[model samples]
Target: MVDVTELEQRCADAWPALVDEPLGGWRLRAAGGFTGRANSALTLGDPGLPVPQALDRVKLFAAAHGIAPCAHVVVGAPVEAAVADARWRVDVDHPGGAESLVMTGTLRGFATPKDRAAAVAGTPSPGWWELAAQANPTTAQRRVLGSGSRVGFGEVEREGVVVGAVRGAVVGEVLHVARLAVRPEARRGGVARSLMGALATWGLEHGARVCALQVAEHNSPAVTLYRALGCAEHHRYRYWVPGA
Candidate 1:
């Protein structure tokens, strides 16, 4: 069986929580409002301080960023109980925040789509960012997507414009996929599959053995697409926000 804990750590490393401050063994991350993975405190292990004290520090750190205090807790982790004891409630209503499923698949036999071609760049191009982010992306969001040690920005052009985009970051043996998006009018056109295929091919060329991604449990369409690609759930996590 794959070591879920190690996989979690790999995911964290692959899509780094930028501007992280360590409080004991916990990571207090803040990256504007990009994503919860970069904006919430990560309870990875023993915090080296009392649970309550660590929680207090998290609150202060989030307050300093002018964001609500939040913790990204792996499901069934010991820290989950501690946070619940302190009155933290899971954000059930937050889109994609209630439960995120980490999925993984082998890249050994992956092949690029024959009919679709993608332009791969070491840094995100203007078209890639515009398509992937939908709106104008903030500097922090760009850094989160493109600043990894080994990153690939894949864009599918249609009619002289980017219609699909995805990001792949290699960390050791894992290729973490993120920021996959396609234009609304381009959905159901295999744009997403082409992007994934291109990224997987790029990852294999760069020595990656496995591909991984996080998707919200509520995103049935995305879940079905990834499952069809042979990815299986490796783990799950949820965001725990302090009760108002």
Candidate 2:
């Protein structure tokens, strides 16, 4: 039998590191905010461990704790592989009931300089952010502009009035682009494309070899625009919203 207390401690210590990994998904973020009221489980044993034993341990542990166990699997090495391979799950009793949504992925590298530059120049950026602010002037445009680690370039102007902007910054060799938006009236304009061009130029100058950003999968238009600009899909991430 694995020591439940030790497993929980191990998870707690490793949680932050998981957050830093782009592929760890949003689950790490959820884990950080989770109360002990949330249960977790893991298998710690030699290689070729029995799946039956692992499941039994989780069932027994969850029964005693009055909460479902979050099973963890380690793959490859003995204990490490066991814990890594072990999967965390909840509400196993109800096959169709509410379970956690998994989010995972790696940040994809962008295209080459020549290809990227060409793509950027080929299209125009939208003024979505600019329009949003006008429709709801209470939006926090300036705050998002200033909050990111680095600010790229792009602003939405309506009738010559600048209202929305996109920003980016560089970390190590990675360019993290965030907070992109355009004004309503500026929609369909090449503002975003221009901003992206500026960002690409800035990133290349700063020695950044890749640019990455996160967007909702359902936003087809945005995704299309990005694809046109040489951005490829890296991963599909789902946010397991609280209480859902």
Per-model lDDT: 0.83, 0.41
Error of 1 at 68 (Å): 1.6
TM-score of 1: 0.93
- Candidate 1, which segments miss by more than 4 Å at Cα? 113-115
Q: Candidate 1 lDDT, tens digit per residue, 145-216?
A: 768789999999988989999999888888889888888999998888888888898898888889888999
Put down candidate 2 lDDT per residue, 1-244, tens digits, no spaces: 1123232333223222212111111111112223321224333333133654554555554455454444432222244333334443333343222222111112232323333312221212444334323333222333333234444444545565555565555554556554466656656866666666666666676666665655554556666767777666543222111122
lDDT value, residue 38 of candidate 1: 84
Q: Which regions of candidate 2 are displaced past 4 Å?
A: 1-145, 156-160, 241-244
Error of 2 at 179 (Å): 2.2
How accurate locally is residue 186 in candidate 2, as Cα lDDT from 0 to 100?
A: 57
Ten-residue stretch with the least lDDT total in model 1: 107-116
